[model samples]
Target: MTVELCAQKAAAAGATYFGVEYYGECYWGNSINSASTQQNANLCTSYCAGNNRQACGGLTGQLGLYVNPSNVVPKEVGSYKTWVTQGCYSDSADARSLPNTYNVPSGTATTVEICLDAAAGFKYAAVEYGKECYYGNYLSPSASKQDSGCNMQCAGSPSELCGGGNRINLYQNNAYSQPASEKPSVGSFSSIGCYSDSGSARALTAGSSTSDSMTVEQCVKLAGSHKYAAVEYAK
Candidate 1:
């Protein structure tokens, strides 16, 4: 009751950001003011009465201001979600023509994050043979074998699994989208057919070679320069 009331009050007061503090008090602000001044997540410890799972805000003086995505583009902190597995399948034969495919160098280590980063635009992503990553719109039902088939450690992150021989560590991209009907099988990122090698695609030559180090803004800029519809991450 108190949290909602405070949010309402903040909204009425024309605050772009609002925070609930010490469980009862509410603070409204026009802007964050300074990026460096923002407190770390640990500082905000007060839980909301309405939902215990959610944090209401910080203590006194330190307000927990929630920034709307509509108002701000959250920085693309390097993160990846490990999704459910799919059966072993071939990109060229079993799986339909993959929209984009990038072969990670044999000696160079590759993580699921790196592969997914390279496959920026497609909906579905799969890592196979530990060193190869493929991106496409959807997975064909006929191509699926069994989840047990995909059991290999990621080349880069050993703690994480990639896929086994001829098998694929398939993932549905939550961020990528398509038509409602056609979207069911397909999933995630960038342009449809834009192609580039790791060094050339996102202009990762010289300094920026690792896909993990690339930011969203940098990817967008590189894609824009090529006049391509979009720039998918991996080579």
Candidate 2:
């Protein structure tokens, strides 16, 4: 409540302001006036807890100005339901009365965050959170653990994962990996023609580079490990 009141006053004063929670215990200022309004908002409210939500569930809401509203107010949004609250209102109908169903998951906590932009005092809009908000999942606001929402970004093919300063490998992402390297199979069979296991020995053994491998009906190999034949450097 204090923060919201302060922000409204700060905005009215024509001075950009920010509210931050530092050291998990200390609060420097409920709202600090500054020239960098947007940056401060992101640093204060858009921390890892919020950023990670983009990767878990895929939510992409823009920073709304003042389009929506909630019940009974002094023309300013209230706490608890503050994020989605637009300018002052008198009822839930006014709050839910967006020009459109603002892009977001319909849920309880989710209802707390919305973005709007009005040409006048209070409007509604869908401002993009980050450049990649559309690319990730809708993460929860409490995603600090590894099992839940992502920390930075989801662990992709090492190179594509979050942080993105270095890479572990192209495959070992999300606790997964492949063998060091794989060798191609060989059989002294056809150099051409759509082929299969036609020969008695089938052309080659699993180990013998020149011997073809045969399926004993007990060993069901992948449908496409071989043309059932072995050829030269032909792809």
Candidate 3:
């Protein structure tokens, strides 16, 4: 079977570790960051497009998916390592958010969490998978190719798989291996968040309703509903 098909199969089988293909050589994603892989993916895309092909093969380049044997986690923890196919991070008094498939839950629990430790003045964090990126402070994304040796790739849509809950900001050196429920102090008020709290808290509590007084989870839950305008976390 082709490497792409193999990748799909491996993903279905719940593999965590995988290798990337580029220019007849293999690159380990877990050991490398997405940037390198992204460059390789770009090379492949260009090579394939030039060859008028849709997939990789029979060409000098055109990255093929690599298959590895590792368990996939609901979310990443401690690191946004190259091997990690996907994840989220952020920096703020607010709790970072992952997609419903990662940490930020949706209609159902389809994801996991990797709550990082809180620190002082952390300014940046990154969430990546393959070549896709979901990083803190990542506002607008532009499509581009990555360096070689890695098989990552990005299509340039921040919201495609990187944004939710009013945009989270991942901090540096933060590490949490537990679920998001464990941290009730992330004081973020997401525009698109999980707000299913007090049956009465749905609507504006009063003329001057705000999230500054609410806990992290409470603010998130409030953000999820249509009643509240938006949570305003204090600076």
Candidate 4:
């Protein structure tokens, strides 16, 4: 069977390791059983019949084994940001329609967290229609868009919005929020951890309560009572 089919079979069978041999052969097993035979990824040079761009298995006597990263928790690359709306990163419509199933099947990821985890191998992760995930090394600046258009709710989590048609929510592990070197001024607020500073240089008005279970909204409201421009909650 094809490499894609093999991977699906392996996942369905509760196997953590999937291997391909001789371009057409597929192998599946758990990590404990395949550790001894693990080899460098370079050795797996056989091109898959289903897709020429991806390497499937290895030469004779060599097995191309891949570890399933479904259960692995992805590192917080940093903050998330919108990428595209009403447009696609590539010209191919199929890529826009089926980000996970097109070209080569990446996997079935239904949530943002799962999509990010599946896309760990790539520099960027994108989600569409709340059920599809795509990975890429780079994104064109021309595909930028506002977050409003990408308001489709994720299938796994109704509260979280994914991307709508022709739209994609992009995220990167390297994305980080840069702290402002200086404080905010009037008509602005500084988001320092869970607290927000109203840009006032004034000392935090005399009394501030320390609560272990305080939300940002509560903190902001409390700070407003004292006519203070800043609210800070310490752990």
Best by lDDT: 1
In model 4, where do residues sit more than 4 Å from their true spots? 1-109, 175-235
After TM-score superposition, the amount by which residue 223's alpha carbon in candidate 4 deviates from its true location, in angstroms, is: 71
TM-score for each of the candidates: 0.37, 0.18, 0.26, 0.32
So what's the TM-score on candidate 4? 0.32
RMSD of 3: 17.5
Per-residue alpha-carbon lDDT of candidate 3 for residues 1-235, written as tens digits (9 for 90 to 100): 3345445655665654444333223333333244532233334432233233344432443345443422322222323422222233222223323221223222121111222211112223343342222333222233122322221221221112332233232334333233334342344432455455455564355443344366545555644644444343340
Model 3 residue runs over 4 Å out of place are 1-36, 45-53, 57-62, 66-71, 74-164, 167-169, 173-235
Please, what's the RMSD in Å of model 2? Answer: 20.6
Candidate 2 structure lDDT:
0.24
* Best-matching candidate per TM-score: 1
Q: Give the TM-score comparing model 1 with the true structure, all chains together.
A: 0.37
Cα lDDT of all candidates, in order? 0.57, 0.24, 0.33, 0.56
Candidate 3 or 4, higher TM-score? 4
Write down the worst ten-residue block by lDDT for model 2.
164-173
Model 1 bad stretches (over 4 Å): 1-99, 105-107, 179-235
Against the true structure, candidate 2 reaches a TM-score of: 0.18
